[model samples]
Target: MELFVDLQIASENQADLPSLTLIEQWVCIAIDAGSSKTRKEAELTVRIVDSEESQQLNGDFRAKYKPTNVLSFPFQNPPGITLPLLGDLVICKQVVEKEAMEQNKSLNAHWAHMLIHGTLHLLGYDHIIEEDAVEMESLETKLVLQLGFPAPYNEQE
Candidate 1:
């Protein structure tokens, strides 16, 4: 599978952001574990922004007026158009860093989790319902563990 990741840094603080290679690897891992298609070409963007942009997007799209860790916007193609576009993931660098520090997790590990979670969202995995949450969280744990990171949910809870 050929995957393209467009990394966009809109945040002034680039302190703990992961590299494009690591971001691509995390996205690929999630896609491989969640997507049904194996050999299709896909592209996604990872846009890192400050809390203000994140809060605006969250308020606009989700109606929550707070800065969120990550927001996934899945691309919806027209009926007859088959594009390789997956979607865009807007991550709040400040929130993520604060979360990592609060959760006592490595910066890279949390970043990987966010990317994997967002990519899974792009592939139609969600945690709104209990069953789906279990499935999605289980897959996420498996993938994160495979990457040698601590279990994210356990730490969060």
Candidate 2:
């Protein structure tokens, strides 16, 4: 798996996030769960944006008019390609930080959870239906636990 991360946020605090190695591990886990067969090579872009940028993207793409914690824009192209372009993940740093503090979870853990969630979305996982939500959440729980974070749904009070 080849992961490319571009931190769009200019804040110095963003530099304190988990290393690229950790992000790669989490992406691989998400890809394994999402894909029917293990992918040989994958390419993904993760962008850490601020609340304003996130809100714009949400409003433009989803018509939500609000900043979301994470957004995944998956790509579909011809098959039999050597490198597969999965999609892009847009994460709102402000929302993530606030949610981490409100939920009493470590910043790193929450970030990891969001990244996993977004990656799953890129892999074509959706939580719109009850059964699908259960399936997606189950995968997320297992993967997040492996990454040293508590189950996201279980963390809800």
Candidate 3:
């Protein structure tokens, strides 16, 4: 899989973040892990924002009022349009940082999990159902592990 990412940093507090190239590699690894059978070019946008922006977007798009870690907006290209665009991932810096600290995980590791999670969602993976959740989580574990990161759902990570 070939993946291209357009990164946007809307967070005012320019905290340290993984390089854009690294993020692109992570996303490609995730997409490949989830759909190795297909050969396609993928494009996506990754936006890093503050909690307030996350909250507003969550409320507007997901009907939730609170800020979450990551939100995926899969593109809705019409029936005939054949753009390789996958979707947009809106990530909250503050929430991710807090969650990592509270969960006793490294920021980079947690970010890797979020990136994989969101990218999988873009690749048509859903976790709302128990079985699907297990499948998606399993794939995430494998992908992150390949990158030398621990399984996200494992407590010992």
Which regions in candidate 1 have their CA more than 4 angstroms from the true location? none
What would the per-residue lDDT of candidate 1 be over residues 66-144, giving only the tens digit for each residue?
Answer: 9999999999999999899999999999999999999999999999999999999999999999999999999999999
TM-score of each: 0.97, 0.88, 0.94
Better candidate number, 1 or 2, judged by lDDT = 1
Cα RMSD to the true fold for all candidates: 1.0, 2.3, 1.8
What is the C-alpha lDDT profile of model 3 across 11-78, one tens digit per residue? 99977787898889889888877764675788999999999999999999989999999999999899
**lDDT tens string, model 2, 27-95?**
788887778877767888887887888899999999999999999998887676545788888888888
**Whose TM-score is higher: candidate 1's or candidate 2's?**
1
Best TM-score goes to which candidate? 1
Worst 10 residues of 2 by lDDT: 3-12
Clashes of 2: 0
| Better by TM-score, candidate 3 or 2 | 3
Which residue pairs collide, candidate 2?
Answer: none
Leading candidate by lDDT: 1
What candidate 3 gets wrong by more than 4 Å, as runs, is 155-157
- Judged by lDDT relative to the true structure, which candidate is superior, 2 or 3? 3
